[model samples]
Every structure is written in C-alpha cells, then in structure tokens.
Target: MFSLKKSQMFALIISSLIVGYTTTMINAKADSGYTVVKRMTGNNANVAYHLANNSKNTYLWNGIHTKAKANLRKYKNYSWRYYGKSLILSHNSKKSLYYYIQGITPNGNEASKIRGIVWHSYLTPGINPNYKQLNNIYYRYFNTDSEYLHYVQKSPSQKLTREVLKLFPNTHLSIQLTKAADGASPWAWASPRVDGYKNILEFPTVQKYFNKRFYKPNISDNTRFKLIKAGLDKSYSQTKRNALTQYQIGIYYYNNPHRLIDDEAPGFTIAIPE
Candidate 1:
C-alpha cells in the first residue's frame, strides 16, 4: 500500500538499467569458450556447470515444516497440481556439494545455509529455478521467528521471470510496486486515538476499522484520528484498499513478507498469487 513518489520511481528505473548494462559487460569479459546463459533465464555458465558436474550426486530430502509436509503430501495424493517428477528433497548442507563444486562459495561454512533449489529440465524448464520452498517452510515451521529466517543468494530478476513462466506459462504476472522504505514488516501502527492502547492494525483490518472510533472534540487524539482518516481516504479508494489488503494477505500467507511463523515451522503452502 506504500507508494513510491515520482522521484523514487525514477531512481529505481535508472538503477535497474545500470544493473542490466553491468551484467552485459561482465558476461562479455568472460572467457571466450564460455557460453553465457542469461542470468534472468536461469541459464548461466555456473548453473550449467553445476548440473553437469553433479549429475551423479545424491540430494537429501528436507521435508517442509510438519504442517507444510502434510499439506504437500495431501496435495500430491489428491490434487494434480505438480507436473513431472518430484526431485529428492535434501537439507541445504547436503546440497552444498553442488554449490561448492560450482565454486559458488569457498567453503562448506559459506555454503551451508538456506538457498533456493535449482531445478533441472525434468522438474522445471526454461530458466534456473530458485526454489522458494525453503523460505515458505521456514515461515510455516517457525512462525514466531520467521522474521529471522534469512534466505541467501536470490535469483537474478530476469531469471525470476523465466522461472515463473516455466511453472505457469501464459499467466499474466503483475508486479505490485511498493516503496522500499516501507520496511519489511507489512503491519504498522496508525497513531492511536485511544489514550492507553496503540491503534495497531494490519493492512487488511485498516479499512474495516477506519473512522469507527470517535475521539472527543478539542482533544489532540481527535485531531490525530481525523488526520489519519483523511490520509487513508485520500490515498486509497475502497477498491484500491481491497486490492492492497489482498496483497498483504498474499505476503502473509505465501511470501511471508514479515516472516511470521505459523503453527508448523518450515511449513509452506501455495500463496494465492496476485
């Protein structure tokens, strides 16, 4: 629901262009024989080399948090959501062999952490798949400490698009832009109208509770409430408010935007995609 001002949008566009240009330069300078796979397509020399070198290695299966595992198993049994064969699940440390061999990290210590799983053509096609399963599992399994769960090595933006296409071809993907300074936590406080308790609310609940409480005239609390209501009403129409609420729910349920843990630690469910 946080919007970027004109200046901020301009800056971000410029920065993205710079990054794209830099990536092109880096690829050009690489060794002559190297086949540079576009990072956005998840086809890179590094990913190809890893797959080729580690074809024989065994991958460990690290099941999602208890809840997510149950859900996945149930889905596997009942729903025909997954296509192709499921790859062996493994703990990140065990998977370190592939990354280490690829020279992604210098040592096991550096490699042993939560990372997106890269999928092969058999499981997924087009670009390198940076698996979000781990992040989802961590949020579900360890709900309270989900905020502390940090993912390492995000897939590049271009590769991310290809990965999405591999999973859901012909889908129209919409990016809902929000301000960078909105903080990772989606829920924030509106200044309190009540004297003692803080008027804390999640984005979805904001509209439902808007302007419901009446503060006494001449009190500063009343003035603050008016200001807040004006801001919310002015910035977001009812339809836009609904959309933003849905977006927040997506963040909470799937992406774990604030990384809140649910009943099961490291559990995951398909978030309702925007």
Candidate 2:
C-alpha cells in the first residue's frame, strides 16, 4: 500500500498532470502510418520542382523513397496535385512523410502523365523570392563543385525576409572569410549539404534562388538566374568534395544561427506574412 501527506499528494498529482500533458504532445507528433492517402490541395504545388542536380533529374518514386517511377524535370513548369500523405519507414527505420502526387498539364496526356511519391519539400512552388546572388560577395568553390554554387554573405543583420543568402558546404566558412571586424553581428553563408535539404521550405517570407543547373525561369529574363559571386573559385579537397556531392539535388544551406540542423543555419527568419 502507498500513503502520502497532503503536500506530497498535491505534488504527485501535479507531476502526473505534467507527464500526461507532455505525453499527449509527444503522441500528437508521432507519425501516422498508412499507405493510401486522400487527395488535398494544400499538399499540391503550383509549379514543378527544379531538377538542379548535375543529373538534371527530379525523380518521383513508386512509394516513399522507393523505386524511381518518373523524372519530373522532363515536364518542367508543370503543376502537381497532391493525393495525400503517408509515413514511410526507411531501411534505417527513419520516418519520412512523403506526398503522393501527380503531375498535371493542360494537354492532359494521360499516358504521359507522371504519378508518384516525393518529399513535400520537393514540391515547393519555386525558389524563395528574396534569394539572389550579390555582385560583391565571394564565390567559393571549385570546378568540381559545379553541381551547386556556394558563396558567403556579410551583413550586420541576419534578419532575412525576401533577401537571398549564399551558404557554403563541405568547408568551414570562417577559414574562407574574416569574422565580424568590430563586434559580432549576424552574418550568413550558403553551401551544399550532405543531408536532406536543410532550408525550411515552408518558412514564411524567406527567399530562395533557382540553381542554374536545374532551373530555367518560365520567362526569358536572365536576371532571374542566380550567378556566382565575383571572387574566389578554388576546388575543395578530395574529402570535402566527396561529401558535398552525396545528393544529386545539392542541398545548399547556411552556417550561422547555429542550433539544430534547421533553416536557422545562416539567415533564415521566422517572419509573419504581410
């Protein structure tokens, strides 16, 4: 039998309530696993993903990270309608929520229509509006790094809205450039990454740019294209290049606001939509 004083009993009850609340939150976030999914507009994309990898391929799979069914790059600019969502367990037992979607065209070529699964991130409408290459920023990379562009941005404020940021990958950003001169102010750098794209695609008002390798704007304006910064283009050491080339998509992200491997990497901000 268990017994407790009045104060002790009150404390015990408080602890139990806290634990229950935490468990509810945790359970709410747990993956809901199912194969078939319902169709939804929110999961849809107004434009197709850019296949910016050296391979120039954006693959859709038979299932979550499963067999490749088709390449969306062939149908560039096409819109996608989302079917639903499903949590899939990879070989490592990691859960990746994938969108089951199909490409649409005005022609409606049923036979040529592409249908498959892809990460929701891949279906972003397009690059962030704020991401653009600066004329004076330093270009950081080798000829081998053509798959993705890298650069450094120096600014007193890291409050990013529609502003473009150039983050580097594989190498340490500090070695390539000097730190804040007088005192530390927010700065950011962009480079390719080995993991899934770290840029929070859903981040409100954050800007992005199209990787020239896989992106061609619907319009003929060359100004929309992202260009390499004006200085420095040295090849990385063999080890660094190997790691940076892990994914064909070339996940480029930032090197500041250090915390979890998140959009906070360099200059991504949490701004309210106007």
Candidate 3:
C-alpha cells in the first residue's frame, strides 16, 4: 500500500480536479467558441420589413439553423423583433450576420407570438417600401397619422396623388394596404410566383396557431374545388375598411412584430395545406 504525506495528497487532489475540469469542457458550447451570441440590451431596430434585395422571397426561421429547417415562412408582416446586436460566429459557416427577432400575428395576441432568427440583409428597418420609401417622399393623405401605424395616410385623393408626385419628383409615394385580422389577397395587388416557396405548409407556426384555432388558412379557397391562387394580400388603409377574408387565396407567408406602422400586409411566401 502506498501512503502519501499531507502535502502530497493535496497535490494529487489538485491534479485530479484539473483533469476533471478539462474533460467536462471538451464539448461545451461556450468553451468551443462556436456560437458567440452575446445577449444585448436595447435592440437597434424597433420596426423592420422583410424585403430581400436580390432574392425574390424572404424567409423567417424558427431558430438559428445552419441548414434550412422544415419550418420556415416566406414572410410574416410584423414578425421581426430585433433581439439586440446579433453577430455570426464559427458555429455558423455561412459567415453572414443574423438578427434575432420575435414574430407576432393577428393583432399581436399572445397566442400568435413567436421568436425567430433572420438574415440581416433580408430585413430593412422602418416603413416597408410598399408603404413608404427610405430616401424618397412619403405621401400623407390624412392630416394626422394613426398611433398604430406611422407615416401612412389612407384614401389619397386624385388631387393629393398629383400633388405628392409633383413634390417628390420620381418618388412614387402610394397609399398601400396594411391589413390586420382579415383582408383579401388580390392577384392584381401582388406579384404571384411559385418558383421557390412551396414548403410553407410544413412550417411549425401553422400547427402552433392553427391548432389553437386562432386563425386557419382562412383565405385561400372557399369552394371545395381546391383552388390554388396566389396574389398580393392587401389590407385597406383604414383599419375598419380592411375587411377580413376567411376565403382562400394564393399568398406568401411572412413573420414580423415591430411593424406597428401598418396593419400588416404583403409578403413573398406562399402557403398550402399539409
């Protein structure tokens, strides 16, 4: 039997502790330095729109994914809630910056709330181009803007239209629909294309909200004929006038939360039934 002095025992215990610590840290996420996400305060963007400059459709993910997850939406109005300064680390090989956002739907009820991670370039902060332009003029038909939606005026008169264009010169400031609750998705109002986004039915939000009967795919088809229609789903400017449609139509899905500037409308993702 081997016996150790008091000092020898202490040295042996210290060595054992160091070895255990090293073993525990082998696959630790923080120690690996893969995802360097630092929780930050005071998010940079309060309101943002999902508009891809190069790509046709913008997608909002359920989480930080290295590969495309089955659950992804083309877009959701008012779904992007900035989660502070988001950066890319070694874990994400794409080397692109991602923003943390929370998505809400249908008047922002708690039932419709969801958190998402999105690409930085896909989201443009403040005033969707469909409503107001970044460097261009923003025409206001009414004297005062609504508290929910900023920089928007409903029912621009013919005379006001001319005046606005004349003032801005080459900037087309138009009154766009910001729909909430329910609205018609007219083909004329949106550019309908089914090239890339066909997997929307697989998204988890469909099950999360639809299972609760919060709001189903109510506006795609009414007749049992199984109509597959796609268009620009628009909500009229006036909150009351923007009628909600339970009928079915072709549409692209989107997710965002900070778009209180408008009722929420128009996206590039399409939805289908499972």
Q: Give the number of the best model, judged by TM-score.
A: 3
The whole-model lDDT of each prediction reads 0.25, 0.35, 0.33
Please write out the lDDT profile of model 2 over residues 1-274, one tens digit for every residue.
Answer: 2555877898999999999988855553343443433333344232323333313556677753435666676665344555544344444445455666665442222233578776665665422112132211111221123211322232212212112322223322221122111011123324222222242122211223222222332422223322221111223233433353222221222222112122122222211112
Over 1-274, each residue of candidate 3 has an lDDT whose tens digit, in order, gives 2455877888999999999977644422132224544434453454444444523544444444443321224333333445565656445353556676665332332233455566677766543333322211122211222311233232221222222122223222212221211122223233432332222211121112211122343432121011111111122122321231221122112222222134323221222223
Candidate 3, residue 50: lDDT: 42
Worst 10 residues of 3 by lDDT: 224-233
Candidate 3 lDDT: 0.33
lDDT of 2: 0.35
Residue 30 in candidate 3 has what lDDT?
32
Which candidate tops lDDT? 2
Reference-based TM-score of each model: 0.19, 0.26, 0.31
By TM-score: ranked, best first: 3, 2, 1
- Please give the RMSD of candidate 2 to the true structure: 21.7
lDDT of 1 by residue, 1-274 (tens): 2355877888999999999988754553331231212223222221211222223332212222111111111111110111122233234323211121111221111132323322232121111122232232211111121121122123221222232222222222221110111112322224312122222223332222212122222334234334534554665444544443222111112222233222211111111232
